[model samples]
Target: MRLEELISQFQKKDKKAFGKLYEMYAVNICGVINTIVRNEARAEEICHDVFIKVWDNADRYDPSKGRFFTWILNIARNAAIDELRSKSHKREKLNLSTDFFVGILERPEEDDKRDFDSTRLKKMLGKLKKKCIELIEMLYFRGYTQQDASEVLQIPVGTVKTRNRNCISQLRKNMSAS
Candidate 1:
């Protein structure tokens, strides 16, 4: 069946449609979560939670606003970001002090080699303008709000917003080129 029909059925609470959607997007969604969280198991858990959230809010999804995958991706991204911001997640990282210290001592020069995507992301950021790179780092990587970024960058919030949109667009272009 077509995606539209499948999504329609999903929104109507069809279990089979839900299972099909899960099978189709689980890996991609989990990968995106892992990109942000850097924890495969946690990413997988969050991916499952995101699907459940999607199922619960199925009726809210409007195709006219965006594609289904884009909607689901945004949800997954936000969920991963939330997980990063949670206190438990922070504590878990704090609990990794031994591993962190060991890693630093053992591979000080290969910090960028911790993950292939980290290196690739660094390369992608290198392709962007200095300002865009800074904005992307602050807004996305550091989880700064627009107002927070504006305050830190000493710019108006509106400018921060516009720059963020432009930077993401540029990044998308660079990613496609690569």
Candidate 2:
């Protein structure tokens, strides 16, 4: 069934449709949270919270505003970012190294066991250049704007958009392949 159909069913409080939607997006949502929190357990907790938020705010979602993935991506990112800003997260003094999400991708053993369809993502991400990874991390994961990414990466502002487009294209290819 189409995502819109599933969403309609979900709006009607259909448990089966909700479960299917959850199954489809849960891992990706968790991945987004993990990219921000950099802790598997905390990311999982945040993922649950994001789902709850989505359920509570289901009436607010409008298809004309954006893609369903984009909507949920924003929710997950906002939730994860909020978690980072919380008092406990601040007090913990977590070291957000330069690599951030890249560090997670590079951890062969742990990334293998934790992330869903790890091998596929590893292979897809492996095809991307280091700069592509960095740009995607900054722009998508870290919520940096084009200007911020360009300044941080020392690239021209014009390059940031194209670079991000290319990076997402690679991700799309990987998603299709998997």
What C-alpha lDDT do the candidate models reach, one value each?
A: 0.74, 0.79
Per-residue lDDT for 42-122 in model 1, tens only? 888998899999999999999999999878888987898787778466655422111221222334446656654354554
Tens-place lDDT digits, model 2, residues 1-178: 9989999888777878888989999998898788788789999999999988888778788888988777888999888877778847666664333475466468767556754555665777877877888888777676777888888788899999988898889988877776
Cα error of candidate 1 at position 50, Å: 1.3
Q: What's the TM-score of each model vs. the native?
A: 0.60, 0.79
The list of candidate 2 runs beyond 4 A from truth reads 88-98, 104-119, 171-178
Task: Score residue 33 of candidate 1 by CA lDDT.
Answer: 75
Measure candidate 2: CA RMSD: 3.4
